[model samples]
Target: MKKKITVILKKNLVNLGSVGSIVKVSSGYAFNYLIPYNFAQLATVGRVRHYNMFLSIKQKKLNEIQSKLQIISQKLNKITKISVKKKIGNNNQIFGSVSDKEIILNLFDITGEKLDKKHLYFPDIKKIGIYNLDITLASDIKLNIKLQILPAFI
Candidate 1:
């Protein structure tokens, strides 16, 4: 017979803590993944007895990280203005339309944030103008950005 257990999560678990919250899970999985790896601990009577201490430490750490993330989010929330330079023909059409990979690289060059090309919302940008884009930063954070497209200087 296998026994189940609850644990105080010290970090992000599949469906657990925002850093430090308690949740219930299977004993074997908890022992194998949570305990050994130190991501969580058994919510035994003794551990629960000292839950306050655990919570205090975890909350302090989470508070600090939240502060830093808030700052980063502020910067991210500010609309990012990016200008793309492309080669164009007679009809203002790019010989080769700009790609998300190119835009991602340019974003990295400007902001130092490593964003995947898939995150850019635009399917294909073939003309010059201001466009809005959405970037998924992990499961919890998403960002919006703008790009200013222009023809490349010959």
Candidate 2:
């Protein structure tokens, strides 16, 4: 029976393993491909301990980020509606469409949380009364906000 060598992955490899993961592979494959390319390292006791420590630190940081996102989500949920003013045309249609930038700025004004416009999911508002906006806070957290468009007299 051939003995498999234990290795710790240094980076994520598709179909292989993730970073900091301990896996066993054939010694030839480990030495030729994984180790030579800096993809993995020999999993000695000390290296394993260090990897475990690194994983713990990473998990701690992830938890902190998640908690902060949760707080932001709570604040965003408190906002029930956002009002936007645009010039009305002859047929009650907005002259300019509402875009993600406008929504992001309004959210920052109301909630005091600065969010990337990429996180907002909405269709272009040409003629708007009440529209639903989906804001992705995290993979697991989403916020729904109502958008109200009022006619501006200029």
Candidate 3:
């Protein structure tokens, strides 16, 4: 049975090319994954038309936000100072850990930008001095921030 579907594109669907394109997909796929993963919705005639117009507005808003982020990223990229305090012994191992959440929080306080924790990459940062963080703002937008972690005196 053919059903009207409204798919709210999320994370820039490979096929959709944007974040609000509502296209018709099979009912089974819609119910099984798209809805659950928050990739789409039921595009009734009314909803479809509404979403189409909304898409333009969303694009405009996103463009504006992206432009602002670009300027911020440029400033952040030049930053080369970050200090993370920790308690450690002679072994140079940190008694506590520096989490991505803390990093994001610190960055937010500094840049006025809410950085997503997932976008903060840390393969290994046990004993840190200075590290480079690669953050993804959007599909095409990205930023690099410096993280300086220092050991807190006991």
lDDT of 1 by residue, 37-122 (tens): 99997677787768877778889998786676566566667646778888887767777777888887887676666666665677
Clashes of 1: 1
**Residue lDDT tens for model 2, 1-154:** 4569999998999978888789999999999899999999999999999888988999999999999999999999899999999998977799879978888888888888899987899878888599989989789999898999999888
How far in Å is the alpha carbon of 48 misplaced in model 3?
9.0
Q: Predictions ranked by lDDT, top down?
A: 2, 1, 3
What candidate 3 gets wrong by more than 4 Å, as runs, is: 1-52
Q: Candidate 1 regions off by >4 Å?
A: 1-72
Worst 10 residues of 2 by lDDT: 1-10
TM-score of each: 0.51, 0.88, 0.58
- What's the count of clashing pairs in each model shown? 1, 0, 12
Q: Candidate 3 — worst ten consecutive residues by lDDT sum?
A: 2-11
Q: Better model by lDDT, 2 or 3? A: 2
Residue 101, candidate 1: C-alpha displacement in angstroms: 2.2
Instruction: Give the Cα RMSD of candidate 2.
Output: 2.1
Best by TM-score: 2
